[model samples]
Target: MEKSVAPDNNNLAHSYNHIGGVYMNIREYSKALSSHEKALKFYEKNLPPNHPDLTTCYNNIGSVFYSMGQYSKARSSYEKALEILETANPSNHNDLATCYNNIGAMYYHTGNYSEALLFYEKALKMIEKFLPPNHNNLAHSYNNIGGVYMNMREYSKALLFHEKALNIYENTLPANHPDLATCYNNIGSMCYSMGEYSKALSFCEKALEIREKTLPPNHPSSASPVVPQNTNKNNTYLLAASWTIAVTVAALVFMPKFRELNCTSAYEGGMKAVIWTDVLQALVMLVGLLSAIIQGLIVLGGFGPTFSIASKGGRIQFDNISIDPRVRHTVWSLLIGSTFNGLSIYGFNQTQIQRYMCVRTTRGAAQALFINAVGSAFIILSSCLIGIIIYAYYADCDPYTAKFISAIDQIFPYFVMEVFSNIPGLPGVFLACIFSGSLSTISSGLNSLAAVIIEDVYKGLMRGQLSDERQGFISKIFSIILGAVVMLLTYVVSHLEPILNAATSLFGALQGPIMGVFFLGFFFPRANHRGCLVGFVSGVALPLWMLVGSQITKNQRKSERLPLFTTNCALPINETITFSSPVRSDPLLDLYSVSYLWYSPIAVSTVLLVGLIVSYLTRPLKPHAVDPKLIIPIDDVFCCYLPKSVRHWLRCGVDHENYLNERVCTEFIE
Candidate 1:
């Protein structure tokens, strides 16, 4: 009794739909768009224009446009989607909610707050009647409504929705569940906006604590840590704070002209010495990191974002432990961001993978991952202690107030600049270390981006065997081109701390929407492709709206609006800060009090909620209709976590012990 199925128009269209969804999630927008177009053509030819599937096709197109930030085009496509869905679906059916949410989001993006609220309300009412009260989808509507209020600076209204969302989520989901924590953090942020520092700090700390408990010790958990408080009045904290100020002024005047004066004679000699030294130290950094950090800086000129500190004769510090989330920084953020950053640069990165794979066995590779996770933990803690000690140095020997470099990220670099500049070959070594960092990072990105393009984008358009040799050649070309791009980027990225903040935050802007889509794919079995597609579009649109709003806010007097993206200290860090006396952090950095770490959880949850509501009101693709391979994992995507022993067995039938040798491997010194 085998049921017969044919690869007809429905099947072909279905295949293209799933493929498009896959590409869309990965940020391969162009390919995703093309795939959706192919599906649309097949649907139009095979089915009537008003077919339910055609509505989905329109919605899919809208989604791709939304991701690409083509708002007008997205709206047009979504309107067509609504027209088809209305024609095919009865009023009050749950499916229309998808269209409602998306269209609402388009309005939201256009800054039509009232219209956005109306549409969101409409979607919320429909879901209220049809879904369970505690359903995640229901909570999403609350969050969405809250978001509109938040944008309008209606703190009271926003807080109302945030609390409602949390009530449902905290009771139903696990404590470590990221969504619940986000609601807490979001609410905390709302309080901060209202000048309720104690309340705001309370919520932010709660969210952060949850994250710290749940995430891998090496992963970025809840990102918003309570900012430390500033204590002054003839104390050590005041002196360190003074040193930071001094460095800030001095660097502003002298360094800019020094580069102008020194020119090429200084450049070539330094680059040669630095690059070679950096490679060796960069390798050494994998093990004896603290010593390497100190020595590497010795080779470089100064301690700053662009150089080392000893070279500059200055330092940065922190006073007491600040539990205030509204403060600019916390132990959690530095540690969490560092952890996540390390994971990202190492995990799924081809350059790191290449190095590990070169080892004889899977066990060797796994050992590397293991060593990395464990070693990195210690390294992170060490960095924290180092920051503490150096700041102590500033307090002890109050350096001149004119020593602060370009931006805060420069603190470390300035330290390097100080340590390395005076020595003969030291600056060369430090420069080498910097180049190696750039190389490793850029090389990994080159391989990853090329693989994504070739595998997802080019596979359908061109034909050839994708042999390892072919991949190698393509990767090399990618590496070269990407290398040039990095150089250009590096040249333009001079204000290191601000650029670092912006670059990481730029990634922040993407994580929310992408993670939301992935969650739907993995867990929401009932969510068909149409719902998936529409939801994703809405999810991204919300953040893009946030970004646009931030840009517009930058136009207003800083005093008028609720501080959104503007970099206010998450807490006041100066010797004195109050409602009247605000601590001015690095004016150059574009971040507000909220760190980029919060973005991952917040962004992911937003996409999921928006996407789910939209999908619930739209058509769900038939699971069996899509290729099993497309839906299932053929290999662990987290292949990076392979244990050293098992990995060795797979790679080469090599003999290896499960236990790592306890003996220290070497006494080598850089």
Candidate 2:
């Protein structure tokens, strides 16, 4: 250091390169370009034309150009960088692999997927030879190749590469490292696209767990490997299933008129027709449920023996209050979680909301809501009664143990078929009911999805005005596409868990966040749209993480089930029955063991908390500026505190004033 050294342009160029890198990472693209250009000039002036410093400079410039979406310029710069790297290290080098990867990215962004895959493979091959097996950069190359394959719809190949990347990351990175999180996220997304929801959810949760532990509160990284939008298809699917059931029942029971009635168009006539049809369906469904309940009671010899047998079978779980999240059922989880789930489904779901809007008056809407609640309660009660009675019927015989049924899920269907075999037309009616319900759900899902796309996405993006008829036509096309896609996906739904449990689990995971968003919009006037979005996203993400982790842990700790037996049970001569032995469950982490029933409540609470906190940090919307109709009044919630006379008087005055205000706002806004 004491010796007088010549002014080293190499060091100056290296400093400039470092500066350019920092600028690029901070997203100051112009400054990054300037710094990189200066570095390139210094290298060109003072160093050899083929110097590595000049190569680095060109690559940096290309990255900056890519960030700015100057694709052609970026490609040219990348080519220049690659040329230098190839000349310097022709056989194998890490820089060469990086250059190839960057070029692949260029093709990928331009929608030339084939070319992108070709370059990505080239990069992978070079990296495999030059880098160590557990190198982070090696993982990056594998990930890139996997991503291209995923885009190409080659799921198996994509999974193989992604797993390779994951293995490398697991070996080299810390348990909670961010890169590992990203790897989990990528695999999760790929699995989701392939319709492997359970696996997708597991991986996504793993990523979320790692991020939560490693990243700071409010850090973008805290939500890394965010669940992809494609995973949301399940929600739509579930909604469709429900709607299809209702519609199918209506069409089958009502026949030709129901078939002719259409609700696709959001017009007065169509809306009215759909509402009347819904009411008819509801009444029919209620009647059917009541008949089933009466029949079940008669078969089970009244409530006493049915309750006793169900209790003996350990099927009644009302008293469970274990805080362990891994527990399958608990009082707190069921009551709190199911409450939120029900509320969200009935209150915030588009299907339910649309039905309410079709009513002529708010009072009519309220009446419809009341009818819905009553119907739902009756359905739940009927289901419980049926389950108890079925258990009683099988308690002595044990159908599964007797080899009459293969699985628990088949027991109910077997019972139905057997019980109604001699009853004229009853079995057919039940089958018809199920068919109608499913069809209605599919139709409704397609219609709702199309409507959302046309109104919110397509129309908003387009500048040219479209006629109502033209828009309707486009929506119809979208509906066809959605239905076709969903039908094709049905094939992948094989080997799933019980339908009711699967549906409920998916709904709980989805509905909580959605309900939270609605709550914020109605209850918290000060919450801005940005805050709502953050809250909604985090709300959805956290529950998914919890649910997936809980399920995975439960699977790992799954106890082997012993064969069921009874005094009258029959078995094949070759089969030997072994009774179940109690196995102590391993302790799980707190968040990993929560009950599935608690998913919705946890999600709603998380959204509210996160939304409120984030809103306070950002600029909040003014309370008075928000739509008055959207706000929930404190008086309504605390109405019990007021005397009946006072409540009635306040309602008379307030209700009329609100009506006048709403009418004025409607006119002014329209």
Candidate 3:
């Protein structure tokens, strides 16, 4: 038989390299390394020393090593790639940028910040020289440099470069693009670090909004957007929203100048003053609510009579805890699910964390948390009572039927207007309180967003330090942009379902997975970042899928509409308003019908379960490698009491006790 001609070495090398790329994406690091090494061997034998194929093979190998946490090996591979690139291409070429960036990353991971900065700056300059001003490559370069500066604690330089990246992304990418969201998120983090909480919040929200639009809800990004699609044909709404956004943006952009020319006293208020101002704002709200309640009581006689009238409407019952998860609320959902929901909201929310961090001591944070819980309870109870009172007054005479309010949500506002109508300036005072409350909430959120952008995204990327004045200047400008972004979201919210309902559902849907990740980090030492990330994505997707399905089921529903009361009772008997009931029952899909209350628990449970499984399946972090501080100290106590069988089943390693002991020792030493 004739000897079979061996496949061309170059072709074989290309094939192996292509295979390695696929393996790398799927995170099969060992397989990826094997394929890339084979490619490199073949390339070396068949191609010239400085061939581009050799450069690619070396770069791929470096990336695989980096992913494997083999920093030294990654650096060596990257250096080889850089050598090949320098020989094969000119000094100013974009290919050199990639090698430089890779090497910079290697140095960054290895704690050689100075070398990282040098290499990153070199890469940035090289790319800037060849790439267009707004090129995405330039954005990448700017972002990398910004990140380095942020790590070095040079806030102003970081902000400058990050803003450059963000500006470029804004100019070149779509509004909802994921890359733009990344930039926004980074800037938000940076602002957060600098203590500009409101601005940080606004920028973070912008990032979230963008991510929701671009990435699929199940993506291992942030809590996913529940809305299925980004584009809508509501041109009129879009146009109106665009106009509002423009005005808001203009106002925010010019706010600092306006402050300079006008309210020079604003920045003079220190943290203590800010806290006092918040207290005053809270008092204004309490006064408004108390005044409204008093007026309501006077108008509706005593509590007993008002309660009797409302009891007839039958809207204040809460005994609906059926096994079906699709029910809106149940005793089971409220007690159990709400705990998870609350934990998710308070435990891991960056906004809450930012506030807690402002406290001078851990004890202060604890006290603040306790106060917040108590205050929240009081507010909720008071609000609920007010609602009951309103229902009692309106039960016999529906406001919608009487044309007293256009929407159900407006009933309270209308009642406020009616009650304070006789009292001169009282209504205005109440309205002002409401306005101030809104302003405070929005301002806080915006500041927080700006902080996150600056701290997380921009701070580690720049080359120099920033003065306090310059930092404040950047913060103010950033806050304006974020505020405008929020205004745009308001428009989107208006076009959606009732804001409160949508917001509640969205929160429940998103919070579960986030909380799960937090618990994984704090409670499960075996859980690696990859597993948590994967589980988070899976967890988010499950609830999102259910929510989307539920919405669809609701839209397709054909059944008797819930009864609406009419004014016919007050009118002549002959003029009674009668509604025809539909014959079909609106049967909901099982998963879709699951109560919204259960979403948090389901999400939390799913993430935890999935994360545990995935962590075990993957190369979990060795007990010795995990930082003890990251794990909850109390968790070890719980683990210690577990049955031997349970421990064995969990592969709670034989050295687990020693691991915890070692960690404690490390903590003591540190």
Q: Evaluate all candidate structures by whole-model CA lDDT and list the values in order.
A: 0.56, 0.68, 0.68
Give the distance in Å from residue 254's predicted Cα in candidate 1 to where it truly belongs. 37
What's each prediction's TM-score?
0.40, 0.53, 0.54
Query: lDDT-based ranking, best first?
Result: 3, 2, 1
Which candidate number would show the highest TM-score if scored against the true structure? 3
Scored by lDDT, model 3 comes in at: 0.68
- Please write out the lDDT profile of model 2 over residues 167-251, one tens digit for every residue: 9888888898767787887788778878888889899889878877765533333422434433666677886898799889876
Model 3, stretches more than 4 Å misplaced? Answer: 1-277, 401-404, 463-467, 548-564, 567-588, 633-670
What tens digits encode model 1's per-residue C-alpha lDDT throughout 429-506?
545555565654554455556656667776667786678676656655655666678778866456333555557655
lDDT of 3 at 280: 65
Which stretches in model 1 have alpha-carbon errors above 4 Å? 1-281, 284-327, 330-367, 396-404, 419-424, 464-471, 495-499, 530-593, 622-670
| Model 3 lDDT tens row, 1-670 | 0134354447777878889999987666789999999888888887889888788888789778755545446657777888877777765388887767766765554456688789888888888788889888888878877777877888788888889998998999888876677677667667777766566667778877876666544222333211111223364588689879978986889657645544322133323333544666788888888888877877777787777766655556677657655556668877887787788778877667767888999999999999989987987788878887776655444555433344666777766765665586787668867876776566566666666777766676764786777766666777778878878888766654445556666777787899988877776778887889899998899988877776656533322122234321121111111112223434446667676777888888888899989998998888667655556643345665877667644543334556568878998999
Backbone clash numbers for all candidates listed: 91, 13, 60
